[model samples]
Target chain A: MLAQGVGIVETIVVLLYLLIVVYLGYLGWRRTKSAADYMIAGRQIHPFVMAMSYGATFISTSAIVGFGGVAGMFGMSLLWLTFLNIFVGIFIAFVFLGGPTRRMGHRLDAHTFPELLGQRYQSKFIQVFSGLVIFVCMPLYAAAVLIGGSEFIATKFGVGYELALLVFSVIIAAYVVMGGMKGVMYSDALQGSIMFVGMIVLLIMTYSKLGGVTAAHQELHAMANVPSLFKGIGFKGWVTMPEFGWGQAKYDLWWIVVSTIVLGVGIGVLAQPQLAVRFMTVKSKRELNRAVLVGGIFILIMTGVAFVVGSLSNLYFYKHETVTGKIVAKTENIGVIAKKKRALEARIPCTLLHIDTNNDGVADVDVVEKGHDVVRDGQVVLPASKLMPAAEVKDLGDGMVEVRPRAVAFLRAVVQTKDGWMFNTDSIIPTYVTQALPGWFGLLFLVTLLSAAMSTLSSQFHAVGTSIGRDVYETVTGKHGHGIGVTRLGIIIGIVIAVLLSSYARGGYFIARATAIFFGLCASAFLPSFFGGLFWRRMTKAGSIASILVGFVITAFWLLFIKDEEARAIGLCFKLFEKHSLLLDKPNWAVVDPLVVALPISIIVAVVVSLMSKPPSEEHLRKCFRGV
Target chain B: MLGIESKGILAVYLLCIASSVLCVVYGLLSWNRGETVPDDVKW
Candidate 1:
């Protein structure tokens, strides 16, 4: 199959979309006259705008591209995450947390999330610490989002990864530095709507192409029992949930599905500074109440569709499997042709080494490795690249012998396959979109993904910048000189950091998991303080500080030392443990996520420490919980 | 284990769409009725 390139029509559509984004940035710049306007859009955003911006920022290229790609590998079990996003990210966040955050934030004249915590506790230390954490840790989350966008661009447009990263980051940075929150929100609304529509179309197209949901799932379920690399980790297919338990009895995907995918991202939304700040963007609790449904629906479509389409891409590849053969190679034809020829052909360049077994006109082919016969049922069909450099044919006592290529070895096909679809799960969605959709519509979908990335990136840059300028610099120095300018400068610094980090974001790092880690980290660090600070009258400054520090440190330590994935990814103390984690059997330590452990610990720390220390002053408690 | 019922997936789809439509309708109806913000309050 030929990989689709951006044609003139697609290019025109994307150029037009860019023009609109520039116009929206101009509008945001015009409205952003003061520091207040820049930070929170003057705290009077409409329900629709607030909801759209929140949903857009909450779901980024990570959710669509990264997590969606995960769905391709893992299947519909990820839909549980969509449920969590709607329930916790929107409903509980807006209904339970949003009102108090807004009321308290307004009363304290808090400009950022850290500032709100600082004033609530009457401690500059809390503010600066929170800001420093954001400044340091947020680049990881931002870089994940950056990679999500750039990966799509690289795959879809055949652009260089570095070039893609530079282009998108610069485009997003341009608006965020100029327009601030208003600009971010404006673009977010536009992008959110595009994402919604694009996902809807994608979903419809996927189901229709796969002969509806039932048939598609049935076909997928038929393929469930394939051997997996993880011990005791064979898929039960696309639709079924992995069985759950503790210690050794759990299914292989149990820890991943329940702990990492569900709890990590689900609970993590509560503490996300970017999404939490949206509650304060609006004027009242009523708007939040109204925004909940929109947010929920937007989340459903964005995540639900992505996940559905992602999983269904399996069917797409299965029906149109790339490495096709059962071909008998002839001496005259040294190379095999691709069985399923679309556009991009399989790039495995295997030449048939002929042997005359019977010495007749017919060539009897038998693939052998290391003096052993590598034939199954009188036929040999293997992926060409896997056997390379290590494979040598042995003398089979027969009339003739030969080996056939996996598929046609187009130059472009070389990069798209290793073994087959299992390795390139991340590219499934991009490949599906380019192949399945019409040229004009595929371009639109590409633009929609770009919009998702930009909206989320803008919000991240704004949040991180505000943290640096307001929570760190101004609080420490007791100076608010050119606050907006300082925040803009912070955005520039953030972009550079994110882009640099994105270069290291190679390998098969799923965007959703990366985003989930950020959320988990945030939840551990911030959820305890946020909950205690908002609701508990006896919450102490010491307790809040302890909770934040413990949560942040423990989660980071767990990722760096305990979690095999993060430890290995960063090469930091992954070898410290006899087992990578406490859960399950040794070696392949199948276990719970860091968030599941750290969040509870942080909460307990906050409660115990608060009990041990003096209660918060009456005025502080009243200010935080006044109208709630 | 029993497979995920197709009906359930359909229900979820309907529920998501219905809820979204409800939110937009509710917001549109109650937009101007919410507590009005003072024009010049600097947050």
Candidate 2:
């Protein structure tokens, strides 16, 4: 297979790049004269490094593989989320969240995200608990990233999934554990450059393959309304939009697209730990300023390229397949049936189907399971045997609606197996990448996959190590101030655990689900206190604690209890020893995009709780509020 | 986006330039420390 030969050469080049990264990490390790150097690169990094590091950390494997895939499934509307990511995730996050985090980091001499939060309120419990949370959850997130990377390599390079996972995970773990944040940042900048070049090249190649944008758009437009069970609900027979009512065809629903993709990711970007640390790395506000321009340009290109190419995937697929029924299994006649069934029957994933055999809102009741149980009614309901008609849900004058079941059930059956517009919920990136790139170009595309996965995994490992070494290890042993070497050991432990979790992980959308849960929990606890501590002078320690605790608990409850169509698609699980959840479906938050509901609640609780609690010391307020 | 349906790569290039300008302007406005940003936390 000369194709395989090209792939092998590509792989070797990538490995060489990785080796250089590991060497940079070693240099960072050697440069470490103190804890600060290891953790924050002595807080004296240049703006260029800061920007690249921020970009690298932000564009995890989730971007290229997971969300990019989603764009393949949905149409390009997910591109709006990419725009929001740049504006909110980067721009607002940098201007709004970055400055204070730096000041707070310096004031408290805090190193990690947990340390910043913990020291802000003078609570060891906060630090330890926050650390524990990151340690415990980061692996799941890390594993998901590993899975995305590994899956891509297996798909594109013809490497075994297990082998790819091990190789990629091991490389990242080695660098992160050995290098620390500086190593991570240094490698991130390099990886980020590759990512930037790779994405641009990918976009060019994608367009070239399709003959041009006009041709691509022409082909894509043909599938605009080919045929679907649900037409009135604006189901453009495209996977990008959900089926609701006349105004909701493919990309029509402003709320679903804005709420789930835009706000969920956009706002959540402010609170991510790995990305936050980059703010603290730069030498001064000047460097931060310089980074703003460079980082903005880089991100715009990276994300813009991803969206443009990803949206054009429809064209590539159409060119390749030439079947107008639309390759998005969800848009297919049958896929429309599944959504109809799920909506009408109320069969969410946890149960594997919508039947209320157990009658609990939890799809917890499964009739029979295939591995993880694709659908459950306390019995095996074979997916729809044939195409089902789409149901029309008509608007009754004033925002009211009624659904026709037989038609809905027909669409649901097709959707159960065939992907349609709703298929953008997951697996879209894989489909598009495979279709868009051919031969060496495809192999080059694999570099994007590899870089994304490795960078994300590095952050996961770094967070895991930092959390365990400082929080769990210190807390359980009641030991304080262990040397850096000891913490490196803790990092090793976290990596091993992450490897195990990823190896056994099974979800079509492990990355999105894991990211949602991780960020949701982070937002619940951190967003409230982080903002309050910086803004409200009267925010008390008692209020902060209450807000964090309340936020964490409520968000978890909502995710575990509430069931929504978006959530069911991603799936969810809990605990270190989680059994195969009989209910394959998860709540909307399980995809776990947190900002939609979790954020507002976090803010409200923090404000209210702070008002009702003791205020921080006047001195503490002065330190936090001095510059402003 | 005006007549985006009709124009081709030239529109894309022009749109790109306009976008960059907006981003630069936005970054400057936000970074201007002489004025305080709403909800910005000053530590």
Candidate 3:
């Protein structure tokens, strides 16, 4: 098929962004003075950077690709979760958690998140436990992100999806390893801005393309059985409703919404090594307080835009899904189509902008890792400009103009009809980005996404390196190693691991979808330990260890044995555990969202164990939560 | 999550506005950046 080509302007927008990011990293490198500079920007990130970093770190491909895709499949009611994410994840986390952590960190002279935990408890074991948790769980989140970005790209681009995954993962690992936290925060600020604008652009585009908000509501409401099937919320049989009170709701979307996705990342953020370090990076509490409002605004914009656009994805998917009768993929290819239109031939270049020149619809083929359909647009104009026109092309004004055959035909059709305009229902943010963006707005969109991806990737590397070096090394040995050189090596090791994991992601959107469930597991294990450590002065090492171990073990049992995704990710290993499942009605246990069960048990264990042993010293208790 | 208490909603808004304006004017006219910061302020 003669592929639909993208416009030069779009390509420039995306490619130019890559150049800018590399340039920023180079700038950060020049400012790098000492060990502290590389690790924590010499403990002097401006409030603006800190605020944006907190917001940027809070969201990733999981928000844009995975959770958003799930929302597309479901409904807009999940938007409440976005509100929760901002209030709890960004606001409370910063206002309540950051200051105490930063203050304690300063007192303890600690650098990493796990180090804070160890020093706080006056226990080497606690530090090791924290490190172990990060080491084990971070891969899941990282893999999920790698998978999300790759999946979006793969599905948008026509080439091998795994190859696309390799491309993005390598680029992220490269820059992050080189930049460190200084580089990460700077990039994060820029990326957070991109995500904010891009998402708002997307929300506007979705509603506009759907013929405005009222029209979208009408179209969605018009779905024959929607009202009867999902009567408001809280309906028992109506599994689609927000199933809160129905405690044991298996991998049900509602439970995932209220308990897992929002709670997992939200609660887990409080404990994240990468995030806690941000508090220590700032100079003073005034900066922290000032950043609070700014952070709230940033998150409100970042997450709010994501959730709003994510909700709109349902409209696009609803349109495509209910074309005839059956519920087709409750997602759309609007983003995909918009992105492909950016490429000269829908071939994803380093950068691309607003429209997909190739009409498969979506902004520049979504990050090529996620498998995508190379849908054929009705004849491509074959950009006369890209082809050099067999002569000097004359009278070509600025913006995208349909002149040649295919583009002319497509343009004529666009001019002729104005009925159905849906962003691609696919989960990638491109759908919203492309549809929401106005003319000449794509360059901004490119910068927006570029920033989000880079920001999250830098933090991931920081977490990975910190865990491996300070946490893992200190756990095995009794003392701190050379700080700067160790962290540098850790950075290298972290990048290598990311590259390896990206290369290994075999399934198409496996990483993207797996991320939410993985985050749920992180929540199940950590929320108890973190909360226990902070609140319960009586929590003992035994209780903490047992709680974390049991929490994770139960989570694993539920995921592999409990969930009904045997078909989604089929494996020979399932056969080994299938009949051996100690509890068969596990999915009934609401296995994916285990914190509803594990957290209480973890709390009980900690309290019981601490009582059995000597309570922590009062001074330790005071210092652990001092100044807050 | 941003749910405000209905009783003091306008009062809080008024306070926030008054504070914001005060900060803005102080920032614009302040001679010393460090002096502008509150004594107890951490960041």
Candidate number achieving the greatest DockQ relative to the actual structure: 1
Superposed Cα RMSD, model 3 = 11.7
Chain B: TM-scores of all predictions: 0.65, 0.53, 0.47
Model 3 Cα lDDT, one tens digit per residue, A177-245: 677677778877777777777767666766777777666555554442432212333422211244454
Every model's TM-score:
0.82, 0.75, 0.72
In angstroms, give how far residue A325 of model 2 lies from its true place: 24
Model 3 lDDT, residue A594, Cα: 58
Name the TM-score of candidate 3.
0.72
For each candidate, the alpha-carbon lDDT, in order, equals 0.71, 0.59, 0.54
The digit string of per-residue lDDT tens for model 2 on A238-324 reads 323443332223333444445555566666677777778777776456566667676777777776676566556655543342111
Assess the local accuracy of residue A376 in candidate 3 as a C-alpha lDDT between 0 and 100. Answer: 43
DockQ of each: 0.25, 0.11, 0.06
Retained true contacts (fraction), each candidate:
0.17, 0.06, 0.00
Ranking by lDDT: 1, 2, 3
iRMSD for every model: 4.9, 7.5, 10.4
Task: Tell me how far the alpha carbon of residue A627 in candidate 3 is from the true structure, in angstroms, after superposition.
Answer: 3.5
